[model samples]
Target: MYVAVKGGEKAISQAHKLLAKRRRGDTGLAELSVAQIREQLPLAVDRVMTEGSIHDPELAALAIKQAAGDLVEAIFLLRAYRTTLSRFYVSEAIDTGGMRVERRISATFKDLPGGQVLGSTFDYTHRLLDFRLLAEGDAETSSPTARDSEPEPEPEEEAGPMGRVLQMLEREGLLVPEQDDDQLPADITEVARSYPCDRSARLQSLVRGDEGFLLALAYSTQRGYGRNHPFAGEIRVGEVSLTLIPEELGFPVEIGTLQVTECEMINGFTRLPDGEVKFTRGYGLAFGQSERKSMAMALVDRALQADDYDEERSSPAQQEEFVLSHCDNVEASGFVSHLKLPHYVDFQSELELLRRLQSETDVAQPVEEQA
Candidate 1:
């Protein structure tokens, strides 16, 4: 007598059609274009690029529009697309010092060799809602800046291999010099023996990590979990060279360039094991202008670097394997969502236990009455 959901397929098809109509909204209005989404919702695009691990703003914007402004869904779309793409070649380590600087600032220093360029940022803007933006035909373009107002580029002075700012102070005998093992950084994928260790790969991972996870890890340091008085030494955003070492050509080849944001945090520290005092440093880098994430990442990076600083590592943020491995949004999302899938067998076992308990309670009630 139980005809088990015979129209399940029909119902699913009808539901999908209804969803499509709802998402499209009233057909009388002009549909949102990809270009409009790209220009209007840039912050969403930036988040998609950062969390999705894709650098193309246009593609990220498209994903955002397709996902109906759901940032996590946009990230998922980008991540899925990224997996399908083939790796042609690995680029060389970009020279951050030689970046075509767009935005640069330092909280630690008032005047650095490179004067700060506060490019396009929302930092100083008031948080009040702009009603004009919600209205059609109200958007206006500002006049372009005068060409003469541009600042001259810094001279091509080959700064010695961009050493840690703190390390420079340590060299003057003002701070403690941590022991340096001559061990070269292992080729990250050598254990698998497939991919090589390169700046591109490292940046790719950082940009795609969950924003909230990075923020939390960074906050832990300030909250006394790791305890570091971190000052944003410098935060820079610009484009850097991407080079490839071809198998046929032994020398590195200039493939192209990419925009990147780099953050360096200086921490106050009293050196131990040698009774020396010195400033320590932490570094973070990512693709695009993700200053918040980059800055947070820098703080977390510094806290994790405590092991190198000879400081006690008791915090979860200091654990490299734990932090780096679990910071991915895709992994977190999948693991969390997977729990919603059918667990009927497990539910049945729980139901049986509850029934047994109820039966035992009923039997005890009669025994209690007799007593």
Candidate 2:
């Protein structure tokens, strides 16, 4: 006997209640606080901030807690919240050269003027597990250092803006000279409305994009789709000034600053216009610490800028519009998930065709006998 199953609403309600209970598990332990998560789980916070397009560690921590530690869901939550925010003003381009660098390094050059500072990184740490930390009051905790032991340096007054490293290469005739243009660069918003082409805007979109999607696209390039040997010229993470120009004020105002990651990739190329061999550069920047993504983005950026590189077309990665437009995860997810909806009519049509084919095949009769 077949019976129609109902109570979908009841089942959904129960599931919600169960989820709530699971999220707030075990009353014995102290509940996870937003501040604690923000401070302790800073890497997670950085990922959320990078993908969320909003740089609030507290909010990201709250979203992470609310989403039950599902990083992707937390990103979605942050993105949704960002949509409700009103845009009061647009900030001027940040001077990254003047950043108060916490960590900076270059793969292209061993020594630079600022010098490489390997701040906090797990690169040198061993992967061995330490069971001592599992027990309460295990080993003697390290004593706190004196406040004046490493006093914070006062902010510099006359720090001259340094030109980009690639600019120096161009001057030395090692890199392809950047074409000079008298025309002013078009505004990003206006270009987005018509056709998105600005590298800054494209990079901004990729910064908040899904890590899985970005990683996959980057992986594809390495797997012979658009293979290009890339060298990380520089990778920097630090705080930069945010200056805003209010329409009414007609003067730049200093807004709150933010920490960001910037990457410059040098790629091999031979210029076509002059038939000269010179290095080409790709750029990537993102909010917070995301060196991997930024580096990958820079590689793809250079590949798409192949025309600018004067390299002969060979791969899909060289197609700027195709690569940039289809790399978004949200759009891909929606299109894929939409297939799960009820398509009774289409299913019925497919079923009829399959049945007809089966019936014709089932009728086993010799050709000679039939004739």
Candidate 3:
């Protein structure tokens, strides 16, 4: 055991040195700059920003570099950094209705007030790799110039401030009524989470939850466990106006816009507080261009609201405690990784106990067997 422990310590040290060498790659090539990661790998940076719950691109880039491109590690780094910053003031909730849209689409509607704008997407692209990218200096000239081609402008109603589809349903008396705006919502970050949490707190936990875990849960719902037959009422990618009220100013002032991905999903049914059944909505919003994460969040959000529909809550996705408890990657990673730490004293105690039990058993054996 002593030899094994000493060997492990030496092995770990050597492995770390090798890892540092591997991370640095070739000495002939220039080291990758943080700015290059920020600019070239925007999607990856966006994911780090969204999952990390921090908005600074430069810091996210640094975390990405420090973690050697491990997104979860980067998120953990950023989240740790976020805890150290001094709190100044809280920003007001953003209005998605007033969003300056970059891309917007809906699966439920073939044609709406705003025509679908397919901007900067891989949706229709073939998944084939060019192979030309492997050749040095070939990537720059081989890039497609699709941006140079401009299509005709969409209709005024389609291009202009397109209203939310579900809001239209609400006006026409087809959707479930929303909660009163006057009530103060619970803050999950400020308060510790418990089972049967309120909607606001549930959503707060989910926004910082693991995207892959939420996606799996959302996918499970579609496969018939706690199925809600959801429709994408709107999946919007845009910049929303952020405003904050200063104590001295008395009135709210526009701080700056934040890029976000917002999804509004229309559930099949929900029983209202007044015992009336109506179509309900599930909402999700995330930092940066994280459409998939937002959509998954909305699906899981509705699944957690199964009690509202009086639906059978047998599925794992419908259980609030199970979902909320294991959804954080940081918590999961720490717990799993801690198993690698030395447990020599604990194991030694267990070994001694077994030896004592064996000795007692030998002494209790028959004299005939000893002969």
Candidate 4:
């Protein structure tokens, strides 16, 4: 058994070497740099950072290259790296209201403050495949001229504070007022797992949860399952500065800025005691310019708000445990991937049991025939 275990360890080490070699691919081709992925494929890096619950773009980019562009695997790598780091300071709450607005839009209003700055988007893009991109890739490798061929961007006008649309409704006394609690928000990473989690914990979970899973849940809500009449109150993408107060300083100090996407989905499913109907909100905040994930998170957030409003919990989205438990892709992937591990002993035992049962059945049949 000892010898067999030693051999297995050697095999695993060799397998890792093969994997590393395969990850490198054809050596003649230029090796993809972490900088290229961080700058060029930024959205992928953003997704990795967001899902991984880590905020380092360079680290995320390195993880992406190491994982061979597998974003989920990259997320796994980032999470694993996170486990090694010591928690220094929990940064002060991010102030999205003071964001350096890059993209801001509202579906409920035709026009509003900051006037729909569509900074960078694929919303108006034609779905047709552009073979030019393939040619461009080839040109980038073969020709240096192709690198700076794209036209330079124009100078932008000085922008004002991009105000929240929800504020406008709030001024009209039409929006539901939020609890003015000064309670420090709990960190999900620090806390022990509990069922039917609080708002802060739930938000943290949804923020870092699987994007595709949340998107599907959001789609289901829109398609009438746990449907809440949602209007995109606001969807904003931009950079927000982070501040942390060290124990020594006792004052807030600027740490760094992170690109974030925030979505506020207004739902009219609840009424007030004053006999005047008001719009309740579902909010989502994620790292980088992740509009879809934030929006989906908002929808799922609203659906999960069913308990607060005494709404029927008939849909999968409304069931907090069901969504929260299964949403962590890392946990889900680990369980699913464990199938690749050896189940030799279990299989052998099952095989022997099956044969013994078959033999007993054969003996019973022969005895019955003789009788």
In lDDT terms, which candidate is top?
4
lDDT of 4 by residue, 142-172 (tens): 4334255683343233254677899888888
TM-score of 3: 0.87
CA deviation > 4 Å runs, candidate 2 = 1-7, 130-163, 177-201, 220-224, 310-313, 343-349, 364-371
Q: How many pairs collide in each candidate, listed in order?
A: 0, 0, 0, 0
- The alpha-carbon RMSD values of the candidates against the true structure, listed in the order shown, are 5.7, 5.7, 4.2, 5.0
Worst 10 residues of 1 by lDDT: 191-200
Better of 1 and 2 by lDDT: 2
C-alpha displacement of 73 in model 3, angstroms? 0.5
Off by over 4 Å in 4: 1-6, 137-160, 273-275, 357-371
lDDT of 3 at 329: 90
Best by TM-score: 4
> Candidate 1, residues 1-371: lDDT per residue as tens digits?
11223447988899888876876789999898889888877767777887887678899988987777778888999989988897776567688877887788778655455455678888898998989988977876675474646745653433223334444566787644546465443433233212222333333445567778888988988898888888887888888988889988899888778888889777876665677677776667777777888888777767666666677878987766676667788878888877776676777888999999988888879777567
Model 1 compared with the native: what TM-score?
0.79
Which scores greater on TM-score, model 3 or model 4? Answer: 4
Between candidates 3 and 4, the lDDT winner = 4
Clashing residue pairs found in predicted model 4: none
Task: State the C-alpha lDDT per candidate.
Answer: 0.73, 0.74, 0.85, 0.87
Q: Pick out the ten consecutive residues of candidate 2 with the lowest summed lDDT.
A: 154-163
Candidate 1 stretches with Cα past 4 Å from truth are 1-10, 13-15, 143-206, 249-251, 272-276, 365-371
> Could you tell me every candidate's TM-score relative to the true structure?
0.79, 0.80, 0.87, 0.88
